[model samples]
Target: MVSCPFAVSCWNKSFPGSQSIHTQVLEVWLEKMFGKYSDNKYADIVTLCWALWRARNDVVWEKKYSRVNRVIASAKQYLLRWKCAPVTCSSVLFRFVVEEDGAITWVRPTRNSIKVTVDATLFAERREYGLGIVARDADGLLVEAKIKCYSGTVTVEYVEALGIKEALSWIKNKGWQEVKLESDCLAVVQAIRCTVEMQSSFGQVVADCRRELRDSNSISLLFIKRSANVVTHCFARASHRYPDRTFDWSDIPIEFQDCIQMESI
Candidate 1:
C-alpha cells in the first residue's frame, strides 16, 4: 500500500510516519502499531485503511478513481458518523455540525463565555510567520483582536502552537474566566488535548497552553474548520499590512470587516 502513489500521498497527509514502518508481515506490523495507539487513533487508522481499500476496489472493479482528498473526506465522514452514533457511554463528544451547504459556520459561545479564534500565516520566503486572534462575546460581537508577526521559519504545526500560546496569554491578561479557544490547526489542538508528554519544541508550546488551561477550569481549546475560522485567517494575512505587533480593541481592520460580518451571519 505504501508503494502506491495515491496511498502514499494519503498516508503522508494523515499519518506522517506510517511509511517508515518496515515489516515482512503486515498483520504483525499492524498488531504492534495498534498496541501503541490510543483508542481514537486506532479508529482513525482502521477507518483510513478501509477508505484506501475501498478507493482501490473502485478503481479495479468499477474503473472509477477517487482523489486523495475525496478518500480522506470519506474516511472523516465515516468516522464522524460512527462517533455520532447512539452510544450509552462516550468520553469525548465531537461538536462538528455540517450545514446544508456542506460548510461549517461559526457558532456563538454560550452565555457567560467568550470565543476566541486564532490562526497563523506562514510567509515562507520572508522566513516569518503571523499570528492573529479575534475574541467575540456570546452575542458574537468582537471584544478584541490582535495580529503579531514573528521572525522564524518553523513548521506549520509549531506556528499554530505559537498562535494558541499567544492567545492564551492574551486571555489571561484580560482576566477572562470562561473562554473557548478555537484554531483551524487540528494537529495543534489534538496535541494540546492529548495527555502524552510532548518532547519536541512544538510540544513545549502545547505544554505551555495546557498549563495555561489548567490554571482555569473554564478555559478550553477546540478545533474548527478553516471556513469557520475565516475571520482569524484574514486577520493573520492582514498582519503584513501593520507593524510587527498590533492590537485592536475597537477599530476593526477594513479588510477584515467583511469576514467578520460574514461570520456574524
Candidate 2:
C-alpha cells in the first residue's frame, strides 16, 4: 500500500517521511511509523490504512477505483464518526463532550486568559495557501481576527505548520500573556509539545514554534476538533478574498458574522 502511487500521494500530504519509508513488510513500516511519531497521529495513520485497504478491496472484488481525495475523505469521515461515538463509561476521562448533533463546540478559556484559534487552507488551483487566526477572550468575545495568503505548492502539514508559526509570531508581537492557543492539527501540536527533534520538511517551522512556546511560560498549545474551530476554518476558507494578506476587523465581514455568532452561542 505504501508503494502505490495513489497511496504515496496521500501519505506524503499528511506524513512527511512517507516517501522515504522503505520496508518490504507493511506491519514493519507501521511499527516504525508508530515508534517514530507522536501518539496523536496514531489514529490518523490507522484510519488511512483502513481506507487504503478498503479501496484496494473495492478494486479487487468490485472492479472499482477510488481517487486519492475520496480515500482521504473516507478516512476522515470514519475518524470523525469514531470521535463522535458516545462514551457510556463514567470512568473514562474525555476532554470533549459530544453534543446531540455529535459536534464539539468551541470552549472558553480560563478566567483572565485569551484563546487563539488558527487554521490553514490550501488553494490548489491558485497554487497558494491561506491562514486564519481568531482571538477570543475568556467570555468568548472576539478580540481580533487576521488572515494571510501565501503563494506556494506545499503539503497540508507544511501549511498547517506555517499557520501555527504565524499565530505564535502574531501573539508575541502583541505581547499577549496567559494565552491558550488552539489548532486542529494534532501532528503539529504534538511535534511542538514534544522535546524530541523533528526531522521532517516542516521541522524548522516546528522548531520556531517550540522556541516561541519555550520563551513564553504563560502560553499553552492544545488540539481541538475541527468542529470547535469553525470560526478560524471559515476565515481560512475566505482568505482568498483578502489579497492584501491582512484583515482589519474594525468592521467584521458579512460572511464571517454568522461564524463568529455561532461560536459565541
Candidate 3:
C-alpha cells in the first residue's frame, strides 16, 4: 500500500524528511516512529496512517479520486478528535434500533428535557437551501417544527450549521434552557461540543450556536447517525416546498404530519 501513488504522496507530504523512513519496511518504520514520539503524537501518526489507508481503498475499490489536501486535512481533524475525545467512553441511556427494512429510531429524552433535531439541504442549481428544526418534548410529541429556505447559495456544511443556529434560537426563544440539540452532522456536533474548531463560512454560524449553548449550563449537543434523524431529514428534503415559512403547534405541513404522528405513537 505504501508503494501506491496515493499513499506515497500522503506520506511524503505529511512527513517531510521521511524518504528514508519510506525506504524501510512499513513495520520497521512504524516501530521506529513509535519509539521516537510520545503516546499522543504516536496516536496522531497512527490516525494519519489509517486515514491514508482508507483513502487508498476509496480510490481503488470505490473508483474515486481522493484529493491530497483534503486527505491531509481529514487526517488532522481525526488527530484533533483523538486528542479531544472523552477520557472515559460512557454508555448512553438512549437505545437506537434498526429494523430489517432499515428503519431507525432512538429513545426519547428524559422528563422535563426538550430535544431538538435539525437538518439542512442545499440545491446547487437553484442556489437555494432549506433547514429543518424540530423540537420534541420528553413525551416525544412535536412541540414545534420549522422549515426555512434561503435564496442565496451556501455549502451543505454552512447550512447544517445554520440549522443548529436556528435550533438554538428556537430553544432560547421558548425559554427552554435545559435542552438537547441533536444533528446527524458530525462536524457541526463536534464543533459545538468543543471537540473540533470551526472554520470557513460556517465559523460564525457555529460561533452563534456556541454562544447560545454557553448561555445555559444544561444545554447539550448530540450526534446521531443519519438513519435515526429520519424526520428532520424528511423536513430538510421538503424545505424547498415552503420558502421562508415557520410553523408552530397549530400549523404543520401535511408531508411532515406522518413523521410527527409516527413519532408520537
- CA lDDT scores, all candidates in order: 0.77, 0.80, 0.72
Q: Alpha-carbon error at 250 in model 1, in Å? A: 3.6
By TM-score, the better pick of 1 and 3 is 1
Model 3 Cα lDDT, one tens digit per residue, 185-251: 7766666657455566788788888888878787777776564576687788888887667776578
Name the best candidate (by lDDT): 2
Q: Give the count of colliding residue pairs in each prediction.
A: 0, 0, 0
Output the TM-score of candidate 2.
0.62
Misplaced by over 4 Å in model 1 are 1-103, 244-249
Candidate 3: where is the Cα deviation over 4 Å? 1-104, 195-199
Clashing pairs in model 1?
Answer: none
Tens digits of per-residue lDDT for model 1, 107-202 = 888898899999999999988889899999888888889889888789999999999999999999999978888888877887887888978998
Ranking by lDDT: 2, 1, 3
Candidate 2 residue lDDT tens string, 99-127: 22123557788888899999999999999
